[model samples]
Target: MNLANIQDFGAVNDDFTNNSVSIQKTIDYCAALGGGKVVIPAGKPYLSGPFNLKSNIELHLEHGAVLKAYPDESVYTKSAFRQNMGEGTIWIGGENLNQISITGGGTLDGNGIFFMGDELHDSYELKPFETIDPRPHILTLVSCKNVKMHGITVSNAAYWALHFIGCYDVSIANISIYNNIKVRNSDGIDLDHCQNVRISNCHIESGDDCICLKNRREYEELGPCKNIVIANCTLISTSCAIKIGSENMDAISHVTFNNCIITGSCRGIGIQNRDEGTVSDIIFSNIMVECKQFSEVWWGMAEPIYITAYPRASHDHKDAGWRLKPGAKEAGIGKVSNITFANIRCKSENGIFLGAASPDLLDNIRFNDIDLEVSKTTEYQGGYYDCRPCKDDDFVGEQTAGFYMINAQNVYISNTTVNWGTQKPAYYGNALYAENITPLILDNFNGTAAFEHLESIVKKGKTQLEKIAN
Candidate 1:
């Protein structure tokens, strides 16, 4: 309310030396004299493009301001930004006017290694002096509502530094995003089909997927992304530090990922709702992980808390039959119910792949107090005179297997621990790897790794529960 009668776009004896045409003529003279705040004072370097925020505006970037991003393309000729979706007509977006507030702490530079990725798809092929593509994101907000972005310091982004689509009562607090390694793909924060989103105390590091959750793309009439809350984040990812769905069909309910801290990730707490829909009450509580390059865990897909509902044509086309099938009366493969993974701690070189390619679409899965360490990449694959964590041969039963439950159902692995580092590569054999699950509940599951058959699965579950009590 008190933006002190706005109008100071890099003011220092303001002769308006093109601070992007003086912050777009003071935001078109405060939206034709009705709105306020466009001040970006305190030391200067304001070079903008693609900033079309209006309704109740308050876009101030104080504290030694450095709002730079003039990768130029006639400064975006809007249609509410030429229909966005991976956006790249060059920069800023907050689709559809809303009460916006982009707070300060100064610094929003997206010179972004000078727009790689085929010059941002040749400026969306609308060629006409085209050649200004810088990976497409310095900031994006689609289908906006009451939005608030706090204390920013967004770094090199030509792609996903911060993006929110189908937004709702959103609030992104204390943000700081980093995109080094030459900013390839550059994802640090992306939440599609957003709902009551609240991302707090962020410090995301990225080359890709530091924090992502997207849904509703197959025949999109998008709706259904409920009560979201992600707290106290500090992720370091080269990919997947915390992810959900790969465009969930059209439903991601009651979500809550509490107290996170993941390190050197290629996969640490990832869930891919196999491209259909319906991912129920999610919760990944009190996590702490450090899995330094677990042999690249196939970073670009293939097991790392991965899931599948399988109608496979690489997840069938033609709207995947509007997915929601749990008992198939209407198509198939879509349903990952009430999930919970409490107190997780992991260290992998290929370990941890939880069930469901079937089993009527994976149900009530839980793994409490879980712990893992399946090291042994052998001092970086030189084999270093074959250092195999004191190999005695059964090397944890051919070294590869911590938890792979396929076709899963009411599965639970409580109070677990599996530490078999340095006998890696019999394709990662087991600690608990079930197939065609019927009855699985290994409580107080302790580990040292080579549980080769774990006494024939506890003597065939005590003779099949005494043959169902005779």
Candidate 2:
């Protein structure tokens, strides 16, 4: 149990040399002697390509230390794990290890901008590659147990910041992720088929989903995603702030999020079931949300709370991939049930939406003590429902409603209120718009339809269109 320093093992912090081999040797020496601490001391930055993490080894970085990634792409290597995110390249990884922790209040810079291409408009397009994407993920820990990562700043990942696949008993706290908002696909904290995870007291800003949970198609043997708790976190993103499953091929359940704040994001608290995975027993409570419509370059369309079940790329999809085995007909059949949201507040250009493929596909949804306000907060166009990567149109041009529910069953709203801004558009209408819902209950609902002041609280039947469909 020796405390090894990287400098002693030939890792000089020159900021020009590829110190990956030196870092790897130091880690190996510590791990070979029954595991210990390896310190990247606070000095000049250490530029490195990639290295493997060891079991029972604490990779501690001092307060001013920075372990930065080398920009060159050819020095990186692909993963050996089968079907784990298509075996992508990774920066720091540990497979089948236990008690692996990355601690100390330092930074891990991914140097993501070096891997991007010229900017068209909203975002920088990724550089074209021959095979799979060559961008290295910042961190990938596969099937590791008792993992701890805290007091660190992870910035500018070309891909996902922290990806834990099929791992268990993970605890992440007091860390900050600052992925550039214009960098597409730079996600933060992706939990794929992980269990017993707790994430608290963190701040994340990203271009993609801040925190996403899914069970990918090829990783079905890892089992369902369950028992995740996230609290006291602030999230900002260009896509959904917190999301579950656009790539889920298995089941996800028993997830809870509380006391989180989202500001100026595209979407918040999204449950998107696009594949065969069934989603149930998810609860979000005591959260504040403020979202706006970004340009069509991003995934979401400003819904504060969006829950939808759609197929991933049906035959009707204009940009369908080469392999569409299910075709458009048998795309999304996952049942989403027992979802609840409580004590929430939202301010957004758009409203809350709960749409499903069928009435039976979504059930037992509840909203309690919700306060929502809709306003014209952005120049981006509103009044369109975004169901991207679906069988039909990616965006459905529906009239904006404070709370729109369609193709659902057993939905209950209690003590919820809605308010429209003074300078709202003509496209906004209806405090509660319902279509194809069974037994929808409204208890103590207090709000009028936007601009219309409709006499009926719950409006059904024919709807109003803001503009003609494109």
Candidate 3:
């Protein structure tokens, strides 16, 4: 295949000049010739602002080649799609493209620090409603199909590194992402309303969620995010390593995460259905998690696993410093069911929290062959469940258990072990806690505490425990 080198199209190798037009010309020429490779040659950094990609084209960055984003807000103006979605500009994007791939052993640098002001020094402490100078994302693909990204290093993204919206048949492998941990909202990869995606052998370290799957509210017409597989990935984040929702207006189903590692994250796995959606048929297996608390800049309580289904507005109104007034239109509670976590090990500061809004219970959750250890570390305070929407003042200074579930049904636990700290904190109480749960099953559940502790673990409404003989 003939390659269309950008140098041939008046693209200088210097890093100072704006090479956007040159690259676009090269891409257009290659795409006009019935689709070929647009190659950026090695040993020089090409600086550009924003450019749209074409269909049936591979943007190949050779080894030692660097594609750096121009560090000027004036260089990027909001596009029509971005303005409609209330999002920032996109540096490299394509719409309605087919058979597009970005493959190389090079780097794509966003120069994100130039956008974030000096206020983001150690912690991301900003004033009230202070703007972070919204910058363009590194790469975005919308309404595309058969997309592939492999063996590239994406770094310093001001926002998300890679975003796929309303796309299908995607494969991302052998990619590495390094984003500043102090930066806000530098998510590694975001799959919104995308389907049939496979992500494997990736190492991601980000300031926000490492790998996030969402059914975005803005793109409701695109349908749900389903049939995704993520495996053999190592993730580290200031927030959750893997997350779903907080923006789910459609269904999210048939997602699996297998054989992954999570380290130094605030939360291991989180499924937060705050909007009107149904999350079901999710499986997480053969995973290792090590989590600790972070600064107040982030939202999380160092939980190993957190799942919740609640109303969209007024749920965390007080903590969020706002409230929905009377007669305001509010979204109904979502549903979460058929979630499985098996063959997992976790070392964390906080326990598992599973919460559901009244009349919309979490159904058919199961834990199998799990080992969890909770200890009080200097990172943050421990031994308390961080279930939201409930009265926050009531849980203060109260003892917490290993597994806390409220408003759930048909929960099963088998071959699970829980170990607490040697010197139990004042808030360390039980091994398992349940409230308003029906048909709870426990089989071969072993804990450091005695069997009497299990019998006295309930702290709220009655849970009908079903004995399962092993």
Candidate 4:
């Protein structure tokens, strides 16, 4: 491969000098020469502003090399393609490209603290523009195909660390990302409206969701995100560790998460369909989770597994001076069905929550060979379920259950076990609680209590419960 070194283009190793132009020149030179490797050598740190990547190019960094973003906001601008969800600038990005790769053992630092402003510690409300400054995402690939990212360490992102929007045939492996827990909106990796993606052997620690999948809001015409596989990853986050939806405008299907470890997260394995999308054929297996409640600054309530399908409100669409107009054709509410969670071992403060909004019901969900333990040693004891249109203001009373289901259909729990902590609070009562459900099946459900007590632990409201004979 042709080698284009940035050092040859007058890019200094000093961290102070802005290396944006030099790096861009090297990348352009490599692309002009029929695409090759643009190498950043080791020894010192190089600082730069936003730069675009080109097709058929490999941006390779040697060991001990650092490519850090320049902290000044004036050096960067919004992308011309306007492919991103938020107003955040793109630090290192590419659009409408093919066969691009980023492979390195070096570090890419965002210098996010410089842009986050002074009031960083406060629980900044999550309004569209009220929370923080217009910080940039570290790396974004938009509408690209045949992308590969591996063996890189990305840290301290101001917003989402790595975002892939409308990309296909992507493979990401052996990467590490560490964002501060105090940093808001610092999601680890977002796969938006992409297909045939495989992510494996990564370690991610972030303040927000660790790994998230979304159907693009602006590019709903691109279709759904499908055939994604994420395995052999270690994740730690204040928000959900693995999530699908929460911004889905189209279908998202055929996704799987396997052989993963999730720790210190507020939620694990969440599917939140808020728009008129259909999310189905999802699976999570052979996972271990250790989750606990965090302060009110975060959104989740330490639920080990939470799935919900709800209609999106107008206010939910209004973010960053942008509003998704209500569709004139009356799209039906979102649907979540054919989901399976098996071979999961979880220690959580909160329990599994399955909720569906009005006129829609969660369908055909299954949990098999799972073991869950609920601990009482948490700071937040609200014990309330967080469903759509039900904020903290609508909390009726304390909740007491290992599994809470509402407005669901054809849910099957087989070979699952629940363990309640000895110090059960007054709010803790049943092992299973169902409301407005139909055809809920329990097969070989074992708990710490006796079989009779465990059977009594099931509390139902307007639900047809079935205990399958083992």
Candidate 5:
């Protein structure tokens, strides 16, 4: 591999004005010359559209170099596999490339705010909509291998900040992603059909899930996504801090999230395996969550570590839609199992809620060493109004349980603490409720005065008395 400086190769600086072909030509030249480093000089801003990469190439940016792209849709005339989805038409996809590294203390601005779709831009012109996806994303890597991206600031993505599709052996570190909340669908990073990836030491803030996982389609024959780890990250968003699909059916397994700090998000952590797909063997440990101001009344919209396999709009009896109806036989799309949430501490405007569907389809869930507190909301969020005073009675459910088991089984909660700052209102407050569930285990559960303790509450339940494990 060789090093090719953009300056040395006559790369245009501060002139995106008709300079789209210049950068692409440089990348092609480097690949043709058997790979090299394409350096962007310091203190200069360059402009180009959809710069593609090849084997053994490094796109290095100096301390102050900036790459700005034009927002004109026509300028990005490349095809789907080459051009941006719709935005200013930047980097389309990274496919079948190997040993690539994008490192720098520079900025890659999508100038995405301009193309944040017509509706969002008109509705909320003043607020930030960083997560809004006017296009596919600022960067998309597909079917690539052994890639490393570090120390770059990616902002104002028209869609997801970074998207990995069918890529393997990749590492993303020390990157900063910020999206304007007014921007719709501006997810921080999305991993779809990817494997063996690691994301750490990143700061992600967006309108949607900071880091999201997907399986493409329910029965698309797509590859399984596994062995990915996310750690040492910070997240704040309007959606789940970390979310796993409403579009899964393609099998996502062996993913882990550890040692992260989340604040001011709709849900601290979320795991949603809708009836369309299967997600198993996922783990969350050593995480801290601070709830901003939101309510999760509807199971579908709430976040904070949830896993639902409910039926979909297009689902039918033969296509896993049976799970949606109240008493239908469990569909066979797949199950969510072997998942664990340990050493998680959450203090929020409201208590935490964790639940899933019936047995024979979803099982093996555990919560250990969990500590949570439900704070009072100062304002309304998610269409609900929080009207509690300093000394009013607001209810507190068991920190470990939010709702009675709808049809869940094999659920275990231990070593948990739930501190309610206010008594539950007349509407919702049960320390823990288990309905239509069997073989549920509760151990070392503790709650404050707001809600009765877990052990005693269950002992007095109206259900049959059969405890498999204390």
Candidate 6:
């Protein structure tokens, strides 16, 4: 093994010494010798500025090693390779590489709290910065093939924790990410325009999405995000546990998430397509979820499963990140179809939501053997649905059903159970509510209204309802 140790290149074990140059020297030495393992040895904190990764090399940390980010503005700068990826540093960055990997059971500590602003007792807030907020993402590896990240710990990323863009043949497993729950956009893992990916056996707790998939406008040349699979993960988040998009400008399809446990989340599973994307052939099965509400500073309303497709206001957020060009030839309307959620057991403060801007935008969604229980456990606000980035009103204030489906077509539910808590509000009423659905099928559904005076089912507009008694 052509191994290069960071300490051999004059890297010191301390809290103050800058080890960025030494680490890069070690990586470069390994790459020059035809690719081998570069080891960050155990027993001390190696403080570092941002460093670049090389191809055909493995960066491994021995047990008990701590590689911490140096949080000084002067030490970090943008590279031509990292354009359009928000303000601040890419702490560990690589682009267009092959056979690169990061492993070993050590820690990469991103000192995220230094960039935070005054705490808003209600929810976390940040000081304004130019272009965007200035906090570093722990890792951003773009256009790399044959990537592997496993058996590592990434802690306290002020921005997205681990972001991979346009990568192929990736495997991420046996990893742990811990971010401050009050930090706003510190997503656990982000896969952008990548393909043939598999994530398994991970534990993540963050302030944002635990796992998110996207196809950003800035990287439209990478094409779609497809053939991805996730399994056996335990996630805790203040946002969605698994989210497809609010930033897709291309197709995201053929995704599967199964055998997961989600707890203490704001939204358990979500698909929020708000751009020119067609999201289809997605399946989520055999999962357990528990969620509750937080303050409105975050986007969720505690719905255990949320799926919505809508259009962003062209006039608004024109300068925002990941947005399709204002007048792209593709009709800016997003479409979602062929999604299935089966054998899900969820307990939440809100219901299952399927609201799209128009019926033509969503179709052919199915739910099977889902057990949903809506209970008021927190003192926070409830009885609303949030469909953001729209031209009209962003929220529905008086949602009154255990299952709220609006402007959808060909929906199917079988062997499902909906139960309301003993202490629910007045806005919580009907068991099922539908509007503008062409064909809705409920086979062996078991539920009733929250209150005796309210009807069990309420229908509006043209609809075809089929029911089989439980």
Among these predictions, the greatest lDDT belongs to: 6
- Candidate with best TM-score: 6
The residue-by-residue lDDT of candidate 1 on 1-470, one tens digit each, is: 43532245432323233355556667667767777777776565656666666777778788877777776545654422233323354356656768888888887877676555433321212222334332557777777898888997888776677777788898988878877633455778877778898998888877667888876452245477778899899887766778776556677788888888887666677766655577888898887766444232224221235444543222233223333333332333368877888887777565666544467677777788888777654333311111111112111222246665557666676887877675564454556556665555667787644445442222222111112110
After TM-score superposition, the amount by which residue 366's alpha carbon in candidate 1 deviates from its true location, in angstroms, is 18
- For model 4, how big is the CA root-mean-square deviation? 3.1
Error (Å) of candidate 5 at residue 368 is 0.2
Write model 5 residue lDDT over 234-343, tens digit each, in one string: 99877778888755657889999999999877767766665446788999999998765533321222334555544343333222332233454433345777889999
lDDT of 4 by residue, 65-86 (tens): 8898896877767742265435
TM-score attained by model 5: 0.81
Q: Which ten residues in a row have the lowest lDDT in candidate 6?
A: 313-322
What TM-score do all the candidates reach, one by one? 0.35, 0.93, 0.91, 0.92, 0.81, 0.96
Global lDDT of each candidate: 0.62, 0.85, 0.80, 0.80, 0.64, 0.86
lDDT (10s digit) by residue, model 3, range 245-287: 7677788999999999999998899997767778999999999
Off by over 4 Å in 2: 79-88, 315-332, 453-470
lDDT score, candidate 6, position 213: 98
What candidate 4 gets wrong by more than 4 Å, as runs, is 79-86, 119-133, 316-323, 326-332, 388-397, 448-455
- Sort the candidates on lDDT, descending order: 6, 2, 4, 3, 5, 1
Q: For model 5, what is the alpha-carbon lDDT of residue 192?
A: 83
Pairs of colliding residues, candidate 2: none
Worst 10 residues of 4 by lDDT: 388-397
